[model samples]
Target chain A: MTVNGVEQVRDIEPRLLLVHLLRDELRLTGTHWGCDTSNCGACTVWMDGLPVKSCTVLAVMADGRSVRTVEDLEGPFGLDQVQQSFMDCHGLQCGFCTPGMLMTARKLLDDNPDPTDTEIREAISGQICRCTGYRNIVAAIRHAADAEAAGRGDT
Target chain B: MQVPAFFEYQRATSVAHVVTLLERFGPEARIVAGGHSLIPMMKLRLAQPELLVDVNDLHELAGITVEDGVLRIGALTRHAELLASPLAGEHFPILHDAERVIADPVVRNRGTIGGSVCQADPSEDLSGVFTALRAVAVVRGVDGDRTVPMREFFHGPYETAVRPAEILVELRVPLQPGAGSAYVKVDRRVGDWAVAAAGAVVSLGPGGVVEQVGIGLTAVGDADFTAVEAEDLLRGRVADEYTFAAAGEAAATHCRPVADQRGPVDYKRHLAGELTVRALRDATARAHRGGSTE
Candidate 1:
């Protein structure tokens, strides 16, 4: 599978989950493993351009697909706008749910471009963030959306 | 960390290939699509299949199209895709209503409609939606293809009429002219399973008389997820709150619900009745407005 714009190959057991493959095999620790069930989206990653819980997906299922993790958020210019917005808005406390939030937020901004506060909350409803009470996280996503709109002269 | 037990995996290239694999692996083999439901069960050791036939690559079973006044939804159609289909929503708003609350967005992106129906969870939303629509399930096997009514699809919780060596290929919902459908669920949280839910499809005749009615109840142990007695009482009757309340009472009195984490038996029964009335009211209003809820 192509992960974070790089192709990776490994011989793994069929029982191995996609989250474990990324964290243990490829060492892409950016995708956190939480809630073995798909309820908690901390293990969320992009599979073929859509977010899915990696913990519920088998590594073998992604055999010929492409995966994008939170580690790939950086661009040549430096930290992605969403990463910068998180720092600006204090989106992290313990930082355990930051990666998943960032990944989901990046996708939301890319898709909706200027999502309303309600939209932002709905998009991240699958993910759990016990810290920061999600207010800062939602604000961070809103900040990123606002920044993108400003860059595109939509403001 | 939860991991599935050791199993052999094979990606099926085609429907024929999937049927062949299933026959070769026998009852011990299981076809997996999306893996959102099956994987969790496998992780908890609830389901232990010796061979996992991955059908994710089968493109033949992945689309929603209408043909001959029937909406044919491929078994591989994802929840997100179904929720986003304007054609589906325009024809049956009940599908959109159910899909919107089936699960969270990310999980919906990966979960398949076929998998959800095949899993046959007693609390599954789509099962109740399909039941209310009186949809048909298309099954493919070595002999050929056959269709089964949604009312007879589920044998029990976690068990479906889909026999081993057969794969459910598509679902066909016949379009009913001047018919409107709606589904209502009450969950503790945003993405939790239904405590008790109800779905209804109502078509009114001249003078606001009920022409046909189908009511489906979920998580309430209603036989086949249908309120047959309630439906019989509503058909040919005036579409009014009086009849609707009677149907609700019939449904509530007949259903057998057990107490659990979500609610006590009486509360669930009350929800079953109330949700049925609400679903019927909305459905009747939509029918009066000419079918499309949008």
Candidate 2:
């Protein structure tokens, strides 16, 4: 089975979570593992075209499904608009949670191109970013949403 | 956070195939609709089933329709769909309100109404709302199909009257015109489980008198409790301040809440009364008038 564009196959217990598989076996360190529990949303990723906590999903359950990480956020030069917004607005200070933040933000913008502040807050409320106090994170998302709505950048 | 070691898998193609597989697997098997609830429980090792019959792909259990003044919601219908549905949004606005505040968008996107009802979590918003609306759970078995009222379907905490071999195929709710409803829940966070919730449905007459009332309370007892006393107090009375206050007090008396991580039992009971009053007030206002602040 392939994960994040890499092809590999191995037999193991059904209990192995997709998070451990991505981190331990595949060595795709881009997908960071924050609280192993599903409460914290730092382990979020795109599974079969929906944003879900990878830590909560089993590797066998995600079989034959495409999984996307923050590594998929690059466009032409450096970072996607969402990530760039996060960097510009300083959405993260610790940087341990940037990947999950970017993926969740990407899905939110994809679903609602121009979401209100309340909508954006509700969308990312599942994720917990301890640094930057979430004010800048909300600002970054708003900037990206505006940029996307105005056709200014590749949001 | 690992899923249990056991579990054979079968991706069902249709409802018939799912029913056959369920019958074949018997008690050791469980159907996975949205998997939002079952999968999380499997990871916690609280439930270890030998077989998982995946009905996520069954097209039969995946639509909402209205016929004969009854709203028929398929079992596999996601909460996000319910939140976005125009029929549900317009007719059963309380269901829409309930779906809007249930968990975050991600959970709502995957969690299904059928899954929530079948899981029968007393703290769940849908269970209380459905029970208040008098929704019927349509079950399918080898013999035939049977309808179970939502009030009787949930026997206790984390328990349902559904049999191991029976599959919940659809939910039947009345689409009454003058009946206005609202689902109000108070939780620590916007998406967390409800500490105490209330779903109130009221039908008002031309003179602004209450014709009928249904109040269902969540997270207040072992199962979703219908405010029978409050309903009795509200029937045939004007939805004025005095009547509403009396009904609210009656409901507050009936709610039996327990203290846990959320708050103290006394606080929960207070919230039950506050939410009941607010939900009844909002539902009555909507029944009398058709404008929403949203």
Candidate 3:
């Protein structure tokens, strides 16, 4: 199966989780596994344009699906608007939940470009940021929105 | 978490293939759809089957349609499809309400309704709502097809009446006029499993008297329970606050709950009563063409 614009094929066990395949086989470790159980959203990734918990998904389940990881977010110059906005707005301190947080935010914004604070909170509720950087996260989303509205680069 | 090493995997392309596989494998094998529930249990090593037959690729096992005033949902219909289905939103309001709050959006997208009903988790929302709505499960085996009422289909926690070789093919819920139903659940988070929930289906006569009342409770027993006493008490009565409160009390009295990690048994009882009252109130209000907000 092709992942993150790369065509790849390999035989895998039925028990091999997609997170393991993305990390161990594919050498893409950006998707961290904070909770092997489905509770924690640390392994969130976009499969076929919808956000799903990677830890809960089997590698076989993703056989014919398009997967987008945090590694795919790197641009020609620097970090994407969502990532930079998280930094500028202080959305992270421990950064354990950063990749999943960023991926979830990307899907949320794609669906609703100008989401309300409640919408942002609901979008990221699956992920738990231990440092409780929610306040700054919200601010950064708003800042990114403002930048987009002003036709300036996203902070 | 690793799936136990004992099981063998077989991906079947059609329903006949699944049936043949199951018949050949016998009771040691289980059919897997979506893998939202089975895979998790396998990872935890809670359920160790010798063989797993993947039925997700069977196209005949997925889809949604309405026929003869009854909504027929294929067994593999995902929660997301139900949420997005116009038939569910139009004909089965109780199911729509429950499906809207199941797990989360991602889980909803992948978790199949059949998988959930077959899993028979007491805390699952759809099972309770389906029971209250008097839905039927269509099962297919070597002898052909049989329809099992939702109440009879669900035996207990993690248990169903489906035979070892039979495949659950579809869920059928009748569409009745003058029927208004609502499901109310309390959870720590919006999409978490219910601490306790109640699905109330109330249809009233022209004189504003209840014609039929079906109340199903979850997270309070081994399986979704029909509150027969509550239904008997509310029949032919005006669905007022007093009547609903009485019905709620009756339902709570019949509930056999236990304390789990979420909360104490007493708290579940209290929540069950509150949710029952709330669901009835909302259902009645909707029947009268009023919004639940009131």
Candidate 4:
């Protein structure tokens, strides 16, 4: 499997989850491993361009697939637009759910550049933020959309 | 962190390879699609298959097509794909209705309709929706293929009529002319497991009379996840409040629902009736509008 555009191959147990493989083996700690159950979006990542809860997906299932985690949010230029928006809008409080929220938000904005509030909420419904800070998280996503639009204007 | 128990894993390259593996592993082996349902259950130590066969790579078993007025959905077709399919939404609105609330979008990205049906969870909404739609299950085995009606496909909770070596490969829903369908579910929270859900398909005849009606209920029935008596009462009757209310009463009287954290028996029964009534009303109105919700 390729992690953030880097091919990673390892002999792992069939029972290992993608979250554990990414955090424990590959040391990509940006992808938080919270709530082993699929209820929390904390382990959310892009599996072939679609958001999937890594806690429920077996590492073996990711074979020959591309997995983009929150660690990929930054480029050579620094933080991605979505990450910058989160910082600008204070989308994080406890910061436990930030990684998953960022990943999911990036995908959401990529799919729908101008998603309504309802669409944004629906997109992140799988994730659980213990801090219950959904208001700013949603604002952060909107901010990202605005930034992208502004960036397009500049170009 | 929760993880599956020790098991041998094999990624099947083709349908023949899967059938051969099923033949070799027998019932102890489990065919994993998206693993949203099975993986969670496995981590809880509730279901531990000795061998796991991953069919995620079989792109052949993942598509949606409508031919000859029959909608064919592949087994590996993800819930997200089904929700986005214009073909599915056009022919069967009930599928879109259920898929929209099956789970959050992330989970839907991985959950497969085949796994939902094959799991045969009584609380599963798609089972009832499919049952109401009178869909057919295409099961492929070592010998050949066989089609089973969706209603008869489920034997009991967590059980199906799928043979040991047979895998459900596709679902065929016959598109009914002049038929409009709708599904309504009341879960505790957004995208949670449904407390009670109902699917209704109604076809209006000349003079706005009820030509035919189908009712499928979830989280209420014991083995058969449908309200046949309710459907019988609505079909051929006038599409009015009186007949709709009577149909609701029939559904509430027939199903055996138990009280749990979701709701009590009486409450679920009441929802079964009320949702049935609402679904019937919407379905009839949609049918009158020619089954297009654009």
Candidate 5:
């Protein structure tokens, strides 16, 4: 499986979930595993550029697919604009749901960079965050949009 | 941690290979496409298959097209794809409305329309929607292909007419000209299973009278989950408040719902009537002219 821009081939069981493949074998712990069921979006990752719960997906399904996890969002220079916006808007409180939020949020910005507050909520409706309410997450997504728009202006 | 029982996973490249694999493995083998439904069932120990034929790589069966005045949807079409397809939205708003709330977008990315239809759960939204539209399921076996009407497709909860060694390949919905359809589900929250849902397709004739109609309810048990008696009354009658009310009462009387967590028998029955009326009204209005997409 090619994950986070690296191709790591290994023999694994068919029942092995993509979440375990990343956390155990690849040691890419940035993607947290929560709610073994597909209910919680904490295990979300970009499969073929779309957000899908890794816990529900088998590792073999990702054999030839390019998977982009939250780890890939970090640039060599610093945090990506969406990741930075989360910190700036204080999108995290308990931090358990941050990785999934970040990954889903990045995809939202990629598809609809200037999503409205309602659109952001609808996009992350699958995710559950107990500590920090969704108000800040919506703000964080908006912050990323503003930053991206400002970046485009500078160029 | 939840994990499926030990099983051999074989990937099938084409529908023919899948048929061959089904014959090879017998009834103990099951096809795994999106794995959204089967995997969870496996983890919960509800379903244990000796072998799984992974059909995710079968690109041929993954298609959605409308031709010959019929919307032909390949069994492998993903929920996200169905929801995003403008052609589907233009033709059947019921599908789009139900898809939006079937599950979260993350799950929709992998869940197939075939998986939802084949699940055959009584509370499943698509079943009611398809039933109202009078859609048909195409089942392919080693012999040949057979079409089963939606009314006869579902045998019982979690059971369909698709026999062993036969796979549901496609769903065909005959296009309704000068007609509009709508689905209304009243769930406790979005993405949750329906507490009680209703869908209706109405076509008006001269003098704003309902020429044809199909009504279906979910979570509230009725014969075939359809308000056939109600549709009978509504057809050839002016689709006004009085007729709609009468039809709703007929629907409420026909369904036999059971008490559960979402609501009691009485409440669900009430929703069956209420939603039926609401769906009928919206569908009739849209048949005249498009209204709010939602």
Candidate 6:
């Protein structure tokens, strides 16, 4: 599979999970694994173009697909606007759920550049953030949307 | 920490190939699509298949289309797809209503309709919705293809009529013009399983008389997931609050619910009846609005 625009090949057990493959094998520790069940979205990653809980997905299911993890958020210039917004808006307290939140937020902005607050909440509803009570997380997403719109001269 | 037991995996490129692989591996082998349910079961040791056949590559089994007054939903259709399908929502609002609460958005992206229905969990929302729609399941085996009514699809909890050697490829729901349908559920959380849910499809004849009605209950343990007695009572009767309440009472009295972590027996039974009435009310309103559920 092409992970973060880089093709990777390895022989892995059929029962291995995609999150473990990314963390243990590829050493992409940016994606946190939480609540091995599909409930918590700390292990959220993009398969093809949609976000999915990595724990519930088998490694083999991603054999020929493209996976985008949180580690790929940075560009040649600097941190992506979503990451910047999270920091500016205090989106994380313990930072355990930050990766998953950032990944979901980035996708939401990509899909609907100017999403409403309700849409932002719905996009990240699958993920859990015990710290910050999700108020700042929602604010961070809204900030990112506003920043992106301003950069594009739409504000 | 949760990992499935060691098993051999094979990716089937075609539907015919999947059938061949199932036959080759025998009863202990399992076909996985989406793997949202089966993998969790495997990790918990509830299911331990020796061989896992991956059917994610079978593009033939991934689509939603309407043909000849029937809505054909490929078994591989994802819950997200169903929710986003305007055609499906226009034809059956019950489907859209059920899909909204099936699970969170991320999980919905990977969960397939076939997997959810095939899992046959008693609390599954789609099962009850399909039962209310009276849909048909198309099962393919080594010999040929056979269709099974949704009413007879479930033998029990986690047990389906699809034999070990066969694979469910598609679901077909015969379109009912001028009919309105809705699903009502009450879960503890946003994406939790329904404590007790109801799905209703209602059509009215001349003079505001009920022409047809189907009621399906979930989690409350209605045998076959249907309220046949309520349906029988509603047909040919005037669609009103009193009749709806009577149908709800019949459904609640007939269904058998057991106490579990979600609720007590009496509470679940009450939800069954109350949700039935609410669903029927919406369905009746939609029918009166010319079957346009906007």
Between candidates 1 and 2, which one is better according to TM-score? 1
Query: What does DockQ come to for candidate 2?
Result: 0.48
True contacts kept of each: 0.89, 0.38, 0.24, 0.98, 0.62, 0.89
Interface C-alpha RMSD, model 6: 0.7
Model 3, B1-294: lDDT tens per residue? 454455778888877788888899998898888788988888888887888888867779899998998889999998878888876777657887898678876677678999998999989888888888899999998888899999898877888989999899999988777678899889888788899999988888877788887888988873556777888999999889999999989888888889988899889988888899999998888777632222
Model 1, B1-294: lDDT tens per residue? Answer: 688999999999999999999999899999999998899999999999999999999889999999999999999999999999998998999999999888899999999999999999999999888999999999999999999999999999988999999999999999998898999999999989999999999999999999999899999986589999899999999999999999999999999998999999999999999999999999999999899895
- The candidates, ranked best first by lDDT, are 6, 1, 4, 5, 3, 2
- Evaluate residue A145 in candidate 1 and report its C-alpha lDDT on the 0 to 100 scale: 88
Fnat for candidate 6 (0 to 1): 0.89
User: Which residue segments of model 1 deviate by more than 4 Å?
Assistant: none
Candidate 1 lDDT, tens digit per residue, A2-57?
Answer: 99989998999999999999999999999999989999899999999999999999
List runs of model 6 lying over 4 Å from the truth: none
* Candidate 5 displacement at residue B205 in angstroms: 0.5
- How much is A135 displaced in model 6, in angstroms? 1.0
* A1-106 per-residue lDDT for model 4 (tens digits): 8999999999999999999999999999999999988888999999999999999999999999999999898999999999999999999999999999998999
| Cα lDDT computed for each candidate against the true fold | 0.93, 0.82, 0.83, 0.91, 0.88, 0.93
In model 3, the runs with Cα more than 4 Å from the true position are A76-78, A145-155, B1-6, B222-224, B290-294
For candidate 5, the per-residue lDDT at A117 reads 90
Candidate 6 lDDT over residue span B186-265, tens digit each: 99988999999999999999988999988989998865889999999999999999999999999999989999999999
Cα error, candidate 3, residue B7 (Å): 2.7
Worst 10 residues of 3 chain B by lDDT: B285-294
Query: What is the C-alpha local distance difference test score of candidate 4?
Result: 0.91
TM-scores of the candidates in the order shown? 0.99, 0.93, 0.93, 0.99, 0.97, 0.99
Q: Please write out the lDDT profile of model 4 over residues B68-117, one tens digit for every residue.
A: 98999999999999999999998888889999999899999999999999
The runs of at least 3 residues in candidate 2 whose Cα sits more than 4 Å from the true structure, single-residue gaps closed, are A1-13, A149-155, B290-294
The sequence of per-residue lDDT tens digits that candidate 5 reaches over residues B175-237 is 898788899999997688999999999988989999889998988976477889899999899
- What is the per-residue lDDT of model 2 for residues A1-116, given as tens digits with 9 covering 90 to 100? 55666666877556677788888877777888887656667778887778877776667767667888788788668788998898888788888777777888999899888889
Residue-by-residue lDDT tens digits, candidate 6, A1-155: 99999999999999999999999999999999999999989999999999999999999999999999998999999999999999999989999888888999999899899999999988998999877459999999999999999999995
What's model 5's overall lDDT?
0.88
Worst 10 residues of 2 chain A by lDDT: A146-155
